[model samples]
Target: MNTNNVLRQITYEIYKQRTVMPEKMRTNYRIERANGGLLCDLWFLTVGCIHDAQGGCVMCNYGKGSGVVHWDKILGELKKIVERLPWEFEDFLLTPSGSMLDEREVSKSMREDLCGILKGIRTKRFIIESRADTISEEGLDFVKKAVPDAEKYIEIGVESSNNWILKHCINKNTTYEMFQDAVQKIHQAGMYVTANIGLGYPFMSEKAAIINTVRSIKDVLNDGADSVVLFPYHIKKGTLLNVLSENGMYRCVSFWSLAEVLGYFSETELSKIQISWYKDYFGEEKSYICSSPGTCPNCERKVLKELDEYRETQNPEIIRRLREYPCSCHAEWKQQMDRENGQIDIKRTEEEYRKLAEIYKTDRQLLEQEIGIMKDEFMRRYGNE
Candidate 1:
């Protein structure tokens, strides 16, 4: 078998052996109004991800729960969340650890209870997050049957259409072909496909990250995705990204980058997707990397306010206004992007060296020198670093 295949088997073994903490198997819920008249009641299931055994995505911390708990108990907890939800919500978003439809992460019994909750709530529409490999037509069909009266939409994490980034950078263990197939099947079932595109992968420059994200969005939309959600790269504790950040290999994208990327999309295109990121999703104690409150103390308020306004209105003029908002660090951000472009694959190379340095304590200086040489050579080849 190939290396990834072998790794997958090993990880599955690890998952099987790992213990689950019942208390951690919790849920997080929130309510928000979407553009037009859609009221969204969103929630996250803490029952850990199946892929966690294989090392979860670099930026994801949602799979923190152990899925080893009792299905009935998990269902009982979800019922409490259902009770907390407002009496009426037009759209219900259930994004659990990994794919909500994945029976491994969310047991069949748990899924049944989820379906019953949807029916009981009588929502006009509902959305679920899923990975490409686990999204089967039959599973979605089951959801449709359960929510016969409501419109069903599936949100897949098509982080990047580029296979290299998906595998090497994000460790998603999914392919573009798989995503395309999933989207095709979702559309075949007469359901809307919403893809969440990841931005700011470590190995590439900001410009490259934006280009890849925009391309993925267009490709998926062209393929069958009705909408796309932009997830700016963020770091979390205990993830590979956190390690990289400590080594000065990764930096979180500023809000300016978010604005620049969204500005690239047309007003009509912007309206189709979800982009209200300023409202903290993780609550008080949970920490997020690169998502600082605002660009600066003085500029943050206006930037966040404008972002919310643009998300609701999708007015090109609002984006234009944001693009013009002057910040002291704008020039520095541009220069950083340019230098990062020139540096090219530094993050990947640095990651390998980091692992080696951690193993051979005495050789840390040698590793640093080697990285310096690599950077110098890169600069020589591409004008500047």
Candidate 2:
């Protein structure tokens, strides 16, 4: 069986065990800097990611807080939250637990109701997120009609530009071509694109991860991304990454690696980039995050503090200072980066999959059959791409 197939099977098996609890709504509110000013960012829990139910990305554990979704209650709560916000916020970002455009996760009625609430807000810019495949002309038209005066941005996750890496390493099941198509549609709708890029995919050295991420950033920008958001890999509980970390096969992206990626971009390019999921700038849910990007204990706090400040200010000088900051771990990290190949270790990956199957008591034959069917469909869609 192909390595991607095996990994996907393992992911599906693990994800199948998740228990859906009764309805409960959870929301997180934060004040962040965006479009050169303060922004009100609101995150609401939904049912879950539809992709996740079908064995999603290797590193993602989104919608962990999701329960049985109550759309009316969620909208009501959202209205109350928006009503309570001070008039000082010039920008507003509404992020659901999953793709806002995927009706299975967030229904059209809920979105229409949510848009009604947004239409009443006084924000200058309105932002929302969706998967590349979920973006549609109808949805964009509805949003544009609702917030006619606000600058609109649709954030999409394009983790990497390399299809092979996306398939075998991250298992994102999203192609760069799909992202390009989404970008074209968003641009046609007169909306800005915020491409979300992930750093530190498993089975690569820090140096290789940095290179891949930098390449992805450049690719997205060239493909018409108005801005980019860098999400340094977070090891979330119950995620494949967490399993790999426990088995000593993976580590979160190092702070040094993040600095290296930033170093590759000029100050002007850096202005269009935003770093996310670093050391707890957004009041990250502790129950979800097993670990985030960091260095040693000696410099971790100082480094993260500076990174938080940089995230808010987007100052190139802060990145320069980070590069110059001295630490013993920096030399060690560099050595590992230089010594290791970036390729995935197929042997170890397969062994881990087998072990997971054993531990989870998964039916190997049935899983293999499912993977075979998936492989057939994948090849049919993207043959020799």
- Cα lDDT tens digits, model 2, 231-291, are 9998876678888898887888789889889999998999999987776554453346778
How good is model 2 by TM-score?
A: 0.88
Residues 1-385, candidate 1, lDDT per residue (tens digit)?
A: 0013322332344344434433653555666555545455445455567676565566665545553555566567778777666566667777776677787776676677677866666577778888888888668876787668788888888888866567545667788889888888888888888888877776566677776677777787778788887877666654556656776766776777787777777777777766745457556564443343247666877887887776666667877887777787766666776765533465665665556356334255555665675556555644542
Segments in model 1 whose C-alpha atoms lie over 4 Å from true places: 1-25, 37-47, 276-279, 286-294, 338-385
- Top candidate, metric lDDT: 2
Candidates in order, TM-scores: namely 0.81, 0.88
**Pairs with backbone N, CA or C atoms under 3 Å apart (clashes), candidate 1:** 48-65
Error of 1 at 106 (Å): 1.7
Q: For every model in order, what is the number of clashing pairs?
A: 1, 0
